[model samples]
Target chain A: MSTATGLRRLTPSSFLLFVAVLAVAASAAALIVVYRTGGGIISDQERAEALAERDLLEQVDVEQGLDTLAAGVTRRALFATAGQHFGLFDARGQALAGDLTTFNPEFRNADWKVVRVGVKPRYTVHVIGSTLNDGAVLVVGRSLSNLRRFERSIFYGFASAVAIVAVAGLAAGLVMNFLILQRVDAIANTAERIAGGDLSARSPVADGRDPFGRVGVSLNAMLERIEELLTGMRTVTDSLAHDLRSPLTRVMGALARAMHEGATEDERMDAVEVAHDEVERTLNTLSAMLDIARAETGLSREMMVRVDVAALVEELADFFTPVIEDAEQKLVIHAPSHPVIAHGHEPLLRQAVGNLLHNASQYAGEGTVVRVSVEENQDTVDIVVADTGGGVPEDQRGRVQERFVRLDPARSSGGSGLGLAIVAACAKLHGGVLRLEDNHPGLRAVLEIRRV
Target chain B: MVEDDAEVADYVAKGLRETGYTVEHVPDGRDGLYLASSSSFDAIVMDRMLPGMDGLSVVKALRAASVETPILILSALGQLDERVVGLRAGGDDYLTKPFGFSELHARIENLVRRRAGRSVETVLRCADLEMDLLARKVFRAGKPLDLLPREFKLLEYFLRHKDRVVTRTMLLEQVWDYRFDPHTSIIDTHISRLRKKLDEGFERPLLHTLRGVGYRLSEQP
Candidate 1:
């Protein structure tokens, strides 16, 4: 089948349609020929019948008043006709007159006969009427072998025509299907190349405006779009690197110069702190980018195990209480009596909590109460960290979860803008969701992970 | 932060010393390693970039040579990749440059506290209190003192802190340094535990919180 397709492929739909069209045309032609030829042939049969009647009239007195010589001459003339054959039966179906005939008395009474007489089947009829002296009837039959010969030739011609038409249909359909499959294969090959990362690859354009050509055009457009996006990403990364390096170099230079100048204790200390903060900001940016990249691989979330959510929350509350108190903020922790165990990476879960605490202290009013709570259910666990501060605008809240997407200006805040990003990354990495919700007068960040 | 960048090295060193730590200064890794190896410092403030060798390699060398001094690798290499390399290279902890003085102080203390737990005596002792490591026995001046495991560690850090105003960060770092969660109140919980253990039924209160700073352990009560 594959070889046939390679040599001459014919899909069944196209082949059936082509053959149908050809068969319709051939059938119409055969019908026309059969009618024209059958009319002449049938009329000839009628003429033969009339001639047989005339012969019967000429022989009417042959077995009665006619001399032997005249009867013999009439008989010879009647017998010479191609369809002539005759037999006469008495009232009781007894054979009375015949020539070169065998009698079966039981067959003589039939009104019509499909008889094989002289090596050919023929249709004949017998008639009986009161006009006969002894109530005898003549049974006659004519050979239809000549008609069979004519019908056979016509049928054979039609059959050959059908065969030729079928072969032609198959040939045409195969060629057409092959051409279509070739064009389709070209498009598929181009797609494979593009999937293999050849963004410049394009489908072969067909000569005319077939579907393949239109598909090629659209595919090229899609490839162009992908290339544009990739280029934009590269440009952004380059710009980011360049922009970050300039400030870093300046910071380092400033620190280096202060030391080279042999500054006083206070002067040197001041320079160090400024430079240190700058470096930390840079590091925070880089870590945010890395976290985004890792999450972009769709969050593998490894080694998830049952976790004591209450213990974790209580732990965080204990860890942050001192820091929060030192910042003059009130830290309140609420954990249920039962262990609210979830399944996820402990470090990532902890990091998310840390980010929440860190972010709250930096943004929330220093003396406000920050509440941390752990709530659990049969199938899931939730850790909520809420702070009363200038809560993120509903519009900016979503963007804040993205790396470097701090809607608030960095200069106005001490944060590196990575705290929320880290929270977002850690939440995702633990197969959990981090959402910013309205805390009424404050903002609430909730991290919810499913239980194993 | 024995950073060759004198400006950075001074504040890091000063900030550290101001936080009640004894910090020695060195401008290069060679001197840093020499000072670290020659004397058993509680913690070494390592600057990632130095004149003689990079900070990562110095830590790696120190670790290779079996020098158990906890090194807080300070670097401007703020990238995650750099942090990974620093930590993987035997740095006990990592501190990005341009860190707040408080953060730097906290991290240094945290690193030291973690290392202190590994080799320091498992049996912690404080003012008329003796804890036997093998025996798992606690005594208040030769009288058996019943205390939970948490109370023991809490008192241990208090004794370690001695009379200094040990902040909450110090307590958390010193006692539960294994936990990465810095947003919780484990310190307070542990402090209350120690208070219950050491202060209960006693004429003396050995553990005291210094309000904004930390707790202190003393016999002055």
Candidate 2:
């Protein structure tokens, strides 16, 4: 691997190791402080004991006599405890009445020092010496093996602590790096597969309990939306081809008939008119499709204004009343006494409501009563158009909202099969929905738009 | 007319000329602006997309230069706000592409007639039919006719542009204040009902349907 990647992988582990090193250094400093203080305390106690012993022997010499002092030293040395010792020597450096085997002339006037005494089993001692009368010397000492043993144990304890901390830090760092890299790799693999044209691939989301899992869940949702759009686009293209082709073929046939040499002027004119009507139909279909696409994009949201929806619906009801009456159907409008207002693109809202009314008039059959009502809720406004005619089945409600989907092929001749689709798009643009419901014996299309 | 498409420009010029209009066409926006500012015409048909300069810029430049000739913008862009943009850029009217010649002709005629500056009249009369704009009433042959508010508005528009071709889109926009085209013959039904009220017992019919084109409210056939 490149040095960059290697450094990246080592970053977390290295940071943890640095922290461990800091901890070890701090602990070592503390241990050294304890060791030094303990050794100083031990040395002070040993020196005090040696000084007291010397003083006591001197007192004996002063109170009793040199002979008595010498005898006392001999008695104490012969029955000494484990960490006690004494020595008495003449000025001539000769051992007198103590267990001290080796003696030096320097010991005659030594106040305090550490010396080695005895032969076969050597002993290290803290000693104090003083000159006595009649050219004699006395020494007092204590063994220092206990202080050495304590210092050694402290050193070993600190060394073991450092070892344990280093090992644990390394292990934890490795485990953390493994877990992070595994999660990252899983996400990367899923992304790579999707980029390689596998749209079905999704990042594994065990749960949304952690940041990584949340990212995976959202990523999968995004992929699902993308796939849905792609499928929708495919369906649109296929339907567009099938729907446009038939009308275009008819137009071509009419034109061919008009261009035929044997055709009379009247025949030619009729053919031309047929072609013209077919082309107009095709243009209308194309424009409706464009309207639906534009509404879906919601690009004209900047043009939204506060529109009195009830007034608009009333106006529409007025506009469609004559036509519905001509069809032998009665039109009724139920609107609030006050203005029902909403924020929306007025033209699109009008078009959506107009489409619903047109749909009802076209399919509600003769003698059916069409009702147009505007109802205001807390956060939404619904413009409903219901007709007492044969209604769409529940299963076909959702399918009818799709582009170029017609429930009845017989009723498809006059429309582009995109009326409800445009209405749905317009509803979505307004942050709402178009719901098709059963009005007992007919269809009730409610176009709900946000109040804002 | 300022247009870049040769066939479309030819077709429009030919149709207007056949209708007794002295037609002038320019394929470039700068030239169209120069000609329009330099000369006077009844109306100008400006294409939105043109060579050398865009149509909206030309319209703005002309308006800035104080050329007050009425302009009708022709655009392939049929977006909802595109018409508003064109009108806001000093255009008197907006016509989407793939329009019928009669629709274009009717719009041009309306533009020219509007430029003629008829004073606001309280009452509009076409033969025996009369509409009182202020009173919101209509009378045929000196007898009062009961009309709904929408029907009154529709008749008022027809009387305002009497003896001229009025397309369905025009009526939808002028009378109903809507832009979307209804699939059914809703306009036809409305007009037929109004015709029943206006010409039901009259000796001569005034509202005549110009088959395959539109309707014409003329005293003569």
Candidate 3:
């Protein structure tokens, strides 16, 4: 089976073979036609020469009498070359004069016929015979060796042409097959390596100049995306394990304390409350992680609708104003009078904006001026949540958007460390991005989404 | 409540009974559909996954039979679109699994009350606090209380469900039309501001925060 497949791979495609066959067939047809026409022309010339010689002899017999014709035939026979011959016979079928010694009864008429004469070296000839008025016979003939030689040459020429075409077609087929196999093998090798658990393997044939090259480029790109997703999945699981552990441990400790012997009612109640709060926090973290995953995977895209960006931001600002004010931060809004509408998932967008504001309220210290603004462009809308407090350091801005990457080791801010991650996911779901920029002195988070 | 899991069924049934609701629990979707269509109930808590039939099919069947009992779908499928699907399948509300009893109870009460269909009232009053629904205005002790649009909505929601326990999730969904949970205490802050506006100079506090559950607005409280 393997050998059969290998042979199949080595062979050129049937389409190429079909074209080669058609080319050979056309050459054969042309050669056959030329052979037929050339042979007919040679035979016609030979027959015409013999008939003209016979007609001249008949004229001599009619004008000068049989005795003169016989004398003429004898003289021509002596001077004739190996290809020329003549015969004269009496009424008793006896040879009168000529190099030719034999004749057929059918040659007695004045019509051309092919007859073989001579001994030791038989020669085929076109001959014509006529009975003179004195009851004598005259014959004239020519050898057909030249016409046979012409037909033999045509046959040999056609055979050699067919041989050359067959050899050349096979050679071209092999070379083309090898080139196609080389390209196919490059893709297959990459696929085999990937199947064998090498996620980073890529086809080396991605030239993007031909169909095979284009396929290779797309395949490599698909592999790149798969590798990225796998890496992301790994990080998410690792962080999830790490993040869930501490809260769970705290819950267990609180429960252990609550179950301790001789514990006072009030202390038991407090421990239970603590455990409950920790459990709630853990559950929130879990749900937030789920939300981020869903958004990143575009599972929430079906909920998208036309939402007014300005109105959403303004309402969120109003919703968070009291919270920011309670933290001793001033809250302000900058939006146009007209609505800035965008196609987006309303709930996710609201959550994303809420998360940004919540982050500001938590990190932006007292007396910070927090500004919420909505800017609209032709195809995109930007929701900017900027704070005028101690901003995040430039280097940490990008890292903060990743899940479970808290700047504070103590985790005193009481966040799930997934807020920015959720915001980024929401932005991506909306075919946009979340950019953490400098607010001069504070962090300015711009959540841009498409307005289609 | 229709739930395949015995533990969940017991927990919900016991909680509803403790809250003065006569609860009937079915452990399969088919049985739940039979009971719901044959008899009457103020509300139904339907689990999404069940034996005999799925919750969505059961809800669709009951609706097709013109059984208008309010249904609250309880499921572990808490994605945004999943919620939409549940509501579109004739469920009155959708609650995710691992929910607190108070959240479930509050939602069930909201569903049942909405089904009861009270005539629309223009003025809502709790003690001396009043809201003119058409005017979109609020007043405490007959003095006009200046409120923002969101504040007015919040007050209107509280007045509408005046003496009932409303969870934070409920308020988030109803007042702001938001379905995602905000990690910050943004709702508490809004409620506090509204509380200040309603009872700053008054002797009695109408808005009461129930620790670990949610808030309640009642004249007796």
TM-score of chain B of each: 0.63, 0.96, 0.96
Off by over 4 Å in 1: A1-243, A246-250, A269-281, A303-306, A335-343, A375-381, A410-412, A430-433, A450-452, B1-123, B126-221
Judged by TM-score relative to the true structure, which candidate is superior, 1 or 3?
A: 3
Regions of model 2 farther than 4 Å from truth: A1-173, A256-270, B37-39, B61-67, B182-184
C-alpha root-mean-square deviation, each candidate: 13.5, 6.5, 6.5
lDDT of 1 by residue, A1-452 (tens): 88787447766565668567868686768767895779567646654564565356435644462333234434654565665555554566555554324444434443334454432343342221112444554455444545566667667777777777777767777787788778888889989998898888877775537777888788878777678658746854874676487559869876986687668877777777677556655655665565445543444344356778788878766656656766678988888988776776664566678778777776788778899998776676888999887788898888788544556654455454556777776676666778999888688999877777
Residues A304-358 of candidate 3 have per-residue lDDT tens digits of 8888889889988888888888889999999987988888888788888999999
Interface RMSD of each: 6.5, 1.7, 1.8
DockQ of 3: 0.57
CA displacement after TM-score superposition, residue A387 of candidate 1 (Å): 2.6
Model 1 iRMS (Å) reads: 6.5
Q: What is the TM-score of chain A in candidate 2?
A: 0.67
DockQ of each: 0.10, 0.49, 0.57
Q: Estimate, for each residue in B1-221, the C-alpha lDDT of model 2 and write its tens digit.
A: 99999999999999999999998899999999999999999999999999999999999999999999999999988766677679889999898898999999999999999778679788899998888888887888889998888778888888888889999888887777677573737888999988998888889999999877789888998
Ranking by TM-score: 3, 2, 1
Scored by Cα lDDT, where does model 3 land? 0.87
**Could you give candidate 3's per-residue lDDT for residues B1-221 as a string of tens digits?**
89999998999999999989999898998999999999999999999999999999999999999999999999987766677789889998889888889889989988888777679789999998989888888888889999988788898898888888999888887788677664637788788888888889899999999877899999987
